[model samples]
Target: MFFCLLSFYGGNGYAENDLQRDNPLEQYRQLFAEQQKEFEKQRRIIEEQGKEIEILKARINSLAAQSPSSQPPATEANNDQTVIAATSPKKKIEIPSKPVGQAPPQASEKPRPPEIPRLSETVGGVLTRKGNLVIEPALEYAYTDNNRVFLDAFTFLPAIAVGLIDLREIKRHSFIGSLAARYGITDRLEFEFRAPYVYRSDSQRSRAVSIGVGEDEIFNASGNDIGDLEFATRYQLNSGSGGWPIFVGNMVATVPTGTSPFEVDFVQSTPGAVFPTELPTGSGYFSFQPSITALYPSDPGVFFGNLSYSYNAETNENVGKVDPGDAVGLSFGMGFALNARSSFSLGYSHKHVFESEINGQTVNGSELDIGQLLIGYSFRFTPKTNINLSLGIGTTEDAQDIKLNLRLPMTFDFLSQAY
Candidate 1:
């Protein structure tokens, strides 16, 4: 009985062990099924995201079409073209009912190729950079009233007033002529000289004022050939592509070369419109004038306007120092590049004297106003030589009512030989 009982116990133990061994295998199968389901879910999500990306890309193209920089007027706009192509659903396809006398084809399922990401688009464009070097000759004239600053340097005004000169259409004629030469060292650097011809009392018909104490002052020489000459140099500090703004600077000196109408009668005359009451050339004095300017350009390669301010220093006379008389000027210009060999320009200039003082005294005498118009053109006959022609017409409150200037300049190239 005892042996039979032990055998029964051993058999029961074996059966329990077999059952436990199968538990691990069954758990493994269940876990595998769960993992497969997760993988399929992720794949579907990825496909849906791809379609969304395509939709976003199409939207971007639509927005680009509406922007201001869009293609030219004639080019057809394609706002929704991309979206339609991307989002349209495919039509159903039916299997061909086997063509007559053709072998039936076996259908094998295969994976489809993945969708590609939208990359950047193709564009065509151009950039332009060009420059020009020119040689020019220029002439200028200016006039003013009030003997205090003119005939007599004594009280900032000449006390005696004689007969005024010729007048036309409510304007007086104070005339001066100049001969100038200009050479462009580069697009940025320049060297120029201007020699002005004086209008002597006998050279032209004009009036003379006297200077002295209160009432009847002494007589003086006629105001002719009393103006001075100027020499200047300019440099372009900044210039980008033709479409951008530009900046330039200039330095100038005025030499005492003209006649002196004041010293003749030696009255109260000392200060005038850049003219000295003493002998011609006002003690051979020296002055410095600097100018800074800004420019803006327009299309059609022509319309560009510039404005500038010139700072002038007064003459150094041992008797007394004269305060600086400066000017504010504006220029409006238009030009056309006729061809590779020629160009044309039209412009207007207006200037005003801001303030002045004589011998440390603020005398409210007169303000000098000037207006002028310019028309000019340049031509190049050969690579070695060129000609520039220019003319100027006075508008009002100036030295002359009519004036014309012309220029012809040639260029020599040391760089050409190397190229």
Candidate 2:
């Protein structure tokens, strides 16, 4: 027994150790053993698969490789195969759609527009603001039959246009064509200039034998022309007076551009009798007018007022020496807005003339004075267009005349121009 056991152990040991001892071929022997074991395992798997496939093929061939029929068993097998295939790793996931009311973001490729604000208007065209230019034209007819005014009948068809530069320094320029212009002469003061044209015509009949003229002869004068030039200035005094009021000294000048042309004759004078005389026309000599004005602004700014007094010094060669020396005038005014579309103004002006020279004679100046009432209103047709109306009633020592006016103002942006 012992010998038999020893023989068994020795034989195994020799079989294993001998291969290892032959070092020249040891690595190759191990590789061959591993390859042989893999081949045997693959062969066993193939044999099992062959058995199953043969069974399935035998059944299929028995069924004559026929098209799918209304057979219960065949249908079951087909369904099972479909389910297995659907669960495979290669399948894609379905994406859900967005909600019905939701919208996707716009593409990154589109362009956007810049934002710009525009100017608006108010009614009667009384007040309109946009660019720096404004033009106003008015056609008016007036009739009066009193001797206290300049005309029994008159017409003033006038148009004004203006442009302002550096008006209020907010870079907010102010301009009303032919009527109003406020511009900067320096940083602390501004200048305003206006010249309104006036035209007048009238025919009158007078009673004879009153002063020295005959009944058959009457005074008749008919013609029209431009009014005067007005220049004014405003100076900022002491940082706006701290709410008490700011005081500004002003100087204004008016060049009388509209004067009546007339011819006179005594009623009892002979038919061939004549008189020599020189008439003033177009524009009167320059008159230096000075005044002091105060502006009072309110908190939250609803009520504001302006008060002023002025003097006009006569410089005419014909009248300065004989009949008139100078004139004194006073103006008191208050302005209040009724709403965004409306405003109200009340003012009074009184002027006195000094006796001076005429025809080289120290003649007492025949009294001539002026009284005024200012009324203005505006209407808006749209945000960009408007119509405005204003009427002024004037009473002179010699006569009382009535005047009416209207204007339409439209604003347009230069950068957004249309062809």
Candidate 3:
């Protein structure tokens, strides 16, 4: 009986031991499963965070490509923080630190300089700015001396033609004072008007042969009167830079408001000797001149040129059918800016006039070629005033020997004050 009890107790002890081992094993399995679930959740969050970081990096690269130099530092930081918060839900993310001594992001490039008016502005006859007014009072003087030889007989038959030679010398002086007003209608357009008064004096000395007898005569004439009225407009076609050239188109019209030479009566002092009663102050024809001007600006200087054509309307007077010749003109020059307020220029001007028609026939000696060398100087008196002086030297016989001109230009801002 004793032996049987011992055996049963040992079996009970073995069962309790096995049950205790099973309970500990079950607890360990549950804890391991919980740990695996937590690991998986963390891995998924890390993957999402990685994907968000990649997206943020792409956006940052895109912004840098668009304007690398213009973006602010604060803007980039805010964007980075926003991405981190959306991706890292359970853990805090550390922002990357910038390198020491790193420079802040820069702004865009500097702006261009303002357009300022310079002495070269008027050298091409173009307006500088809108709402600007320029008043110019000017004076011009010219002197000319001419000699003519007249033969009464034909040149082919020298033996049949008697020695009839006449020599005439004429000296003339002219002075003009004018007031011109220019107003800018827009930045590229300008209007101009000019009125002039003229004074003239002429002296003629002639030696004539009549029937082989020579006689000398002298006459003098002087006149003072108003000259023609002129109106002009200038429009700038382009603004130039670097190697490009600025172009301007101009149209000028003249009115026959002064005394016409043809209207004056001729007094016969002696046979074959006729003198004008009064001197003429104008061409007595309505005319229009169309021109184009070009200016190319280089460093410290500018080059300019102009081409023009003038058309004069026909007129009827006491001298019968009169059609004045059309004329074409060309000028070229270079201007040097001596300083901020002064400039000098040298140029050449040429004009070719077509033959004039009288009574439907072309007149001999009516076509003229005129050329001149021009020198000009300009000085700014004040911010609103400038003085210009010019000299013209004749290069052709028909041109005046010398001419002097002075102009004073003053500016005012009428519209600005009104506004």
Tens digit per residue, CA lDDT, model 1, 1-419: 88899999998999878876867987788789999999999999889868876765654455444534443243222334434444444532221222324455679532111111100000000000012233333333433332222332334336544532221112223444555555555545666676665542211112233322233223323355545677777666664354555555667777766653223433233222122233342324456656554444444344444455656666545446666567777766666667777776777777786666678776564467777776766677687455655565667744345555444444444445447
Error of 1 at 83 (Å): 60
Predicted structure with the largest lDDT when compared to the true one:
3
Provide backbone clash counts, one per model: 13, 27, 0
Question: In candidate 3, residue 155 scores what lDDT?
Answer: 62
Q: RMSD to the native, candidate 2? A: 24.6
Tens-digit lDDT string for candidate 2 (1-419): 99999999999999888768777587888899999999999999889767755654554444443333522364655654454345443753221122223356776631111100101110111111222233334345454555321122223443322221111100111112345544444434656566665544444443322234434333343434455567766554444533555555556766655452222222322233222232223344456666655445442122222333333433435223322346666555544455555444455445565554565565544555756564655555676555656555766633235545555555444323532
In model 3, the Cα lDDT at residue 11 comes to: 87
For TM-score, the strongest prediction is 3
RMSD of 3: 17.4
Q: Which candidate order results from sorting by lDDT in descending order?
A: 3, 1, 2
lDDT of 3 by residue, 334-409 (tens): 8888889888888888889999998899988889999988888888889898888888899999899998888888
Better of 1 and 2 by lDDT: 1
Model 2: lDDT equals: 0.44
lDDT of 1: 0.49
TM-score of 3: 0.69
Off by over 4 Å in 2: 1-144, 148-181, 184-188, 210-219, 236-241, 256-283, 298-325, 359-362, 378-388, 394-401, 405-419
